[model samples]
Target: MRQEPEGYAWSRFGQPEYTNWLDESMSWKETCYIGDWSFLWQHRFTGPDALKLISDFTVNNFEVFDLYQSKHAVHTNKDGKVIHEGVLTRFGDEDFMVHGRGGFWLAYNLEKGNYDASVTNEDWFMYQVSGPNALALLQKLSGSQDLADARYMRAVTITVAGHEIFALRQGMAGEIGFELQGPSSIGAEIYQAVLEAGRDFGIRKMGGRIAMINHLEASFPTIATDYIPAIFDEDMSGYREYFLSSMPPFAKPAYINGSYDGKDISEYYRSPIELGWAKVVTTKRNDYLGAEALAAEKQSPKRVLRTLEWNGDDVLEVQRSLFEPGEHFAYMEMPRDQRGYMWADRVEVDGELVGVATSRGYSYYFRKMLSLATINVDHADVGTEVEVLWGAPGQRQKAIRAVVCPAPYKEDRSRGQLG
Candidate 1:
């Protein structure tokens, strides 16, 4: 008899959920939240060669990276596959900060290549205050009722809880939000102040489970969740070993989920266009690594990112199996993917494999099961019929019917909110 294999899992970045998962998820839609983001890495670069070196690797048009402004930076391999991506901010002519794994990619390149720049990882703490009431909370904490004036992706330094914080008018939930970044030493002070001040506005604390709901609702593709880190392959083995050596045991990338019938892991790598970041790639006369290849690939992308709406009845049927059946499918975790494995599920059209779905989750705001999928362009049209191969392979897998829908399943309120 085969005991169900110990299910895969991941640790939430924070202490734990303050509010329950369901309420915390609904907070983004009804009120607001303060999400602990210190788990993400921030890499800072300074010196004359910093901008040039970054430009050499980034797919974005850095011609417009002015002080106090930030751009979505994406780095791809020589083959045009995304190596890493995150927000790149310019604080001065030659001083910059990039947050997320993209920082690791930059760090790796800095060590190998000859560049006259100094790179250091900063342990700065980051907190996201988001939703309709987010600005209200910021105003209350900073006493800067005028904080609402900060434009999108622009950074403004202000004192909050008596600590200087660089507040960027950005958000993950696609709502009116601010990313408060500052010294790690005062992270606790700032976080506590905001929580107390935001009580009136109904601010909830976000946990790992509910924090990423908007990624699916707003249609943001994520690394590790959507595709494996590009650093794990043979071509990147040297860098991969070096990267893993410095990390803790729990941080390794060792899980593969879903029923992707691919023999090679590289079969899952995605290009910028396929990931819905085509606009970020700009070569226009300036050649970067993979510039020519990406320019060519964009002309005819194999697939495009989209949202798949699962059939409610079929989904319910899968859940119903849990009670009576000898072999029941895994239960759908709320707000985000559970069972690890990047939550990728194979997509098919008339039983012919077409693409793979990633970032599967349920959005209570929309009251639907949603997943970000990189589908074959041939069948990428809205309203197209397809099926999601749910559950682990050879483990009571079920085919749930689905429909092609818009990538951002909801309106992105983060675009141009004034306050």
Candidate 2:
């Protein structure tokens, strides 16, 4: 028997559930919720080449990148596969802070390149307050109407709990949201303030158990969850060595499971185009790394991201199999996918593999089981019916029926429409 892979490894914030998973999961949609993401890695790049350093490898155009603006930066390998991605906020003409694994990639290249840029590992607190009433809660805490005029993807200085911090309007829940970032020492203080002020607004503390549910419903394909980083390939062996030796153990050795096993590791990788991030990639500049490959891919992309609604009856039948004797199917974890590993399933049409399904979870708000899938462009259409292969290979696999739906199964209210 194969050893099952573990879920994501991160320090827990308070308890696994402040209330309950079900109620907490629904808070983002019905009311509001705050989740701590301070565990994410951050790096500050400074000097004349800061923007140039990022622009050289990332797909985003920086010709008109405004001050105090944040871009969902994406870095791809020579083959046009995504290596790392995250939000990068510009603080000054030559100063920037990027969150997530993207920083690691940037830092590595900075050391090897001849650029005048330098990077420092930063420590900070990141908390995302999102939902319909998210902005109202922030306004109450800051006691200012300035946030009401804050543009999407722009960072503004706000005083909260007597401490000033940068609030970037970046929503990850398909609703209006803000990410408050500041010194690590004051993270706890501001968190308590937000919690206290949010009581009347029905705010809930989001736990790790159901944290990624918002990402699923909003069509955000995460790094380790949706696709593995592109650094593991043999060509990137040097960087891989540096990554393993320099970073913490939990960040290394990403494992994959489920039925969509591929022949080569590259098969598990994804490009910006395939991941529905084409708008951010610019073909105007041909000098960046992998620009040629990405341009060619842009001309003829193969896969596209989408949502899959698993048949409720079929999902229930898998659960029902536990009591009735025969070979029991793999247990379907409720509300979200297993945290530690990439739980990718095989998506097929009439027995022919067409796509890979991931981030499988149940949404209480919708009362349906949904998963984000990268399907073949030919079969990637709303209302198209497909099948999701559940359980590991040779382990009572069941082909559960599913339907292709909008990439963001929920209406996207993240940008330009704040109330």
Candidate 3:
């Protein structure tokens, strides 16, 4: 059997067993599931200017963030194109841990030698405890009923299974979830303790495939797939070398396969508007890395990321109708279209090309097909009729009708209640 990650358990039993367990536990019953997110890059930034550096680099205003409060941050290029996105948790006045995608971008910033910031990758383990009964399970494990008092995004130092750990009430499952992060040495103990506590709650371990599909329901965008890194010209050469050398072997094969959209890397760059990040970009703040360009783009916003629900029957019929079968439907990547490298500003409307679709997925829970696309502001209004090219040119090409709608088609279910 292949060895799993340091903090993960092998789910080689079978796909159906694992998938069914996750689906049932996460849906109807109040159950908990543990996920190993240790592969995610964790950085510790400490220095008086650390906060300032983060504010200058990301679209979210970090000045108002209080200690122990976590917020989402997005780093954009000078052209307002999205480079990296993650969650920033403030532990102290000058200390915070940035979690999620974009380790390469963080390393590039350190190599630039521009600020007084010091970054240290933490040798940590992340465990996501999610489900309707997560809080009860955690309380039972830690022997502390105060687990419910820990508000969302709030971090508290707690002891679990006789091991000290930091528990953050954050997750991508769109359910009541908490991330338990601590040293690797004690990871197994923590996992076992949680499992023991969750025994009566029907807890199960989830794989990457289960998590990936659930993230789509949460409308989470991953780096390297949903967007590309924004390497400055001066840092490109060094960045490329680092990415090639430092990436895990499992990721290397995919990187070599390039053209995630089956087109080109240039088609992978996207702006904040195209990734459903409009609320995070604040132009009123002082000059930032992408202030000027983003400001101009905001005034005359070309495209906005909106969600679309595919007609289920129509999509299924098309697939079943194929006799000899044809190329499977390609999910949206970057630029939304393959005619050429389409930036946020160049998208048009009417006789013009309005926008580009970025990420698309089928929601099993909602029983609907959904996609996130960036379109011209004129056509961004909800309910606006739009046409999306179904297939590539010179193939079975056709325009599919779609309606403009708010992103996160399942918003209510996502933010309903904390377990």
Candidate 4:
């Protein structure tokens, strides 16, 4: 089994048990899980131009994020395609930790060396406590519920079982969740304390298998899984070396082979707008890496990202009817074929297709088979009819019924008022 960084115990899935805890925590009254976010690159920027530099590189306006507050940010290329997306936390004047998908972010930051920011990829510990009784469980572990009032993306330092850690109210699953970030040295102790405290609340460790499955319902896009990494300009020599040296074994083999427009695999690059990141694109800022290109694309975005629901009966019947029982219906990365650089086209519409269907999974909670795709805006209106082609040429092209719906097909119960 692949062992995670210190403080995380290995699971039968070869991933850490804490990942499984995240999935199990949702159903339980209260549950806690520890994650080794060490693999996520960490950078500290503390200069006059730190905020401005980041603002110029990303789509979100950072001026609005106050100290102790956090918000999601997206880094795009010259084409405004998504390179990296994560939570940007404000620690002080110009100090912050941007957490989430980092492989491309680290490379992009290195390329834009004009800034005074200092980036570091080191070992950091992160844990998540979630569920209906999460606040109470945190209180038991930390000796205080001061964290309960902390709004989403807000961070606060607290002592738990003699260990000091920074707790942030943020989670991928739509639940009352808190992320505990601290030194790797204290990870094991902190993990044990949270698990012990959660015993009475029915918390258990989680694995990545279920976590990947649940991400579809959470509406959180996985970097290489749901979409292709945005690679701007063929001069990726620096990026190639960085990936070879710094990328972790778990995150390596980045490319999803044969998952693009043609079988060649070089035709894939997704912009922020195509990935359903319009809210984060702030035009108020004068300039950024891909601002101009994005602005033009925005006027008439070639493609769009949307959620699609498969006919329930069709999905089940297929599952039961597979003769050879091939790969269990994993998500497809099929691209729309259009004339020139037109965003991926909707299978049903001749309009430009910008995005491809990235994630598709069975929502056990919702009891429906749903998919997330990035297509053209003209085809994005909710209730719009579309067709999903299955199989390859000859034996390929079975049209499946699809409907355009909200990005998050699953209802988020995490934002509700807690007792």
Candidate 5:
């Protein structure tokens, strides 16, 4: 099947860039940005066993899940590999909604499990406004103290554009950001209202091209880009069949490009712990799926997530080969791939394979080519030098020098802590 081209998400609503991507890239940090994410799959689970159903499948401990609070829910297979993960928000005692690809997996389990939960695939428009002035911009529109009172990972309903919407305080840009969500009926209205009201605050409309750069900088490992969903293994054939037949085509048949080519599909699969999401995975609960394995793996994770800064000179040499050499290295797109392909390159230490690098992108703010890599924990310390073998295997390749850094290349300010 033909893969979804790059910029697919952005093109669904508007152009890849309203202003130049370079400027738009800095919006969230310098001023603020408003980006649409209405395409994310959503599912509403309600009934007495709603929390139980979620708790049974996910790694998070809902023992004290507060109303209107959100958790990064990670669902793993029996062997502790992540099948899907998303932001799950508890709206009420028995009502919850989750956003992302995990909805399908949750829905499938709801049908198979002996739970009293009923899930409804709901539609909503999710636009995130984030940055130093993100709250200031929203403050102009809502004029409600509730906006300022909202806590991180918590949702508060406030009126926006004459519509009562749920504003979730969560920042993907690692800044103070609020995700405005409501029925699709008021999507355009609220979207336009935010844009118009944001003019004074210097709100920039983010395009698809630059939207994911924040994800890279913030170290949010995406499903296909950072790691493949754990649904293609032999043990998961049942769910795979269900996923292929029921889920969207783009979510199926995940493709990997660049240097890291492992023989088995499981090689691409990653656990939440490997992705530096250990805090979200609780080992106290043994009832959840993959609890035993996750608990054991959490104690001694073989590989951990880190950032690799590619050598500028060696990276430029690959680009220079295009003009003079008979055989040119693969083209390096600026600011990252727009095609949404998982650029998994191989990371080596002393010419020995130690890790796989994914989500390679260029940060205009940092002016460095960076990628998130899941590598052996022994060599994951900061400033550890490694070589990233760019280009595909069996094809012309370049061993670019790289240095280890923090997974989140940028300082995190998502917790509403502004200086």
Candidate 6:
């Protein structure tokens, strides 16, 4: 939603960009950076039908999902387009927690069926303590020593600030990390305790403005930043009407950008395969909502998400344009897209429309202008050059040079050095 004029969690008591994001980004990799993620919406499902309801709609194989374990659950539409995705944490056979926009999708699914599952919206505050020293800082907290040995995607319950918290073995930044989730009643206390414990480890509380640098470097395609939420098709007009009536304008794709003048909103829908979620799509043992469509789509995918390393010289010139007299392009905001549009800019190869670029931002950690693009498979080869249109629609556009780079452009150390 047009969240706020600032649109970040900078309101936190700790320093936001104490010096600058360039330093914070470096600290986040070399040492540690703590980020507040309490604004992320969460859904709790508890009932005899909880597993049934969730499994019936998602493509993840629950056979591998055990208590305290989690998976990056992907839920697709009837057309195999990704409708919902989140870290699905299983507490029991019937109790579950979903943290992300997928919670809204789960709630919508509840209304469509007569399932016996009960869903609760949780207003928990989440903190991401991550980087090389993340484990060291977490080890300082009470009941959190087990985090040192926690496996990827595992959840551990810890008592901090006299409150029970779930420490999820995850991070968007792709480092050794734990996502601390607990009730809001003790949020301040927990924050204080963690801060006190982290004082010796060179921890920096990252500002909201540069929060998304991790997503770009780690290859996480977000909803608004990456693609429009696939919620507006002819088949989804009912859901669209319901969503538009209840949700804010920023949450709905149709109401937001209107970036591309194309009549079909479906063109913006990204499939699980296209979004680099191929490994999570499984059809063994149970049927999901979009089984047939996903099976068909698995045979071939047109576009795949790739990193666009914007040419250094051209990017330097774009930044220099900010002071020039007249004709300038869409301003390149650092760390993330501050303007908040989906940024459905045109991507062309030899003057032919080949793909679309989204999620343009600067990464001081990478020290390069970066963006995520869903390009045609043929043009997605690493090192292939393509042109990214660098202006808003009807503006003086410039074709900035870019090249296809490997997704997760750097090695992810999240799964390393447990214990």
Best by TM-score: 2
Q: How does residue 339 of candidate 3 score in lDDT?
A: 19
Q: For candidate 3, give the lDDT.
A: 0.63
Candidate 1 per-residue lDDT, tens place, 47-147, comes to 99998788888899876777989888998888888888888999998899998878877778888889999899899888888998988778877888557
- The true-versus-predicted C-alpha distance at residue 311 of model 6, in Å, is 0.5
- Candidate 1 yields a Cα-based lDDT of 0.81
Model 2 Cα lDDT, one tens digit per residue, 31-126: 999999888889999999898899998999888888999999999998889998999999999999999888988888999898998899888999
Put down candidate 6 lDDT per residue, 136-191, tens digits, no spaces. Answer: 78777775668877889998988887788889898678888888888888888888
TM-score of each: 0.94, 0.97, 0.79, 0.81, 0.96, 0.91
In model 6, residue pairs whose N, Cα or C atoms come closer than 3 Å (at least 3 residues apart or on different chains), thus clashing, are none
Which should have the higher lDDT, number 3 or number 6? Answer: 6
Model 4: per-residue Cα lDDT over 1-419, one tens digit each: 11122222223123633443335535533354444454465665556667866776778876578998887878877767666788778788867677765424643664566776665544667776665667778877787667866777788888987877888887666667788887788878888888788878767665544554456666776675666556535665656466546555544434332223444334556777777677778877648878888777777777777788767665554444454455433223211111111122225543334336655655555656677887667778899877655433333234556778887665565564344
Give the Cα lDDT of each candidate: 0.81, 0.87, 0.63, 0.61, 0.87, 0.77
Model 6: lDDT of residue 91: 87
Q: Give the per-residue Cα lDDT of candidate 4 at 37.
A: 50
Residue pairs in collision within model 2: 7-340, 8-339, 8-340
Error of 1 at 368 (Å): 0.5
Deviation in Å, model 1, residue 387 alpha carbon: 0.7
Model 2 misplacement above 4 A: 1-3, 6-14, 417-419
Residue pairs with colliding backbones in model 3 are 303-375, 348-353, 348-354
- TM-score ranking from best candidate downward: 2, 5, 1, 6, 4, 3
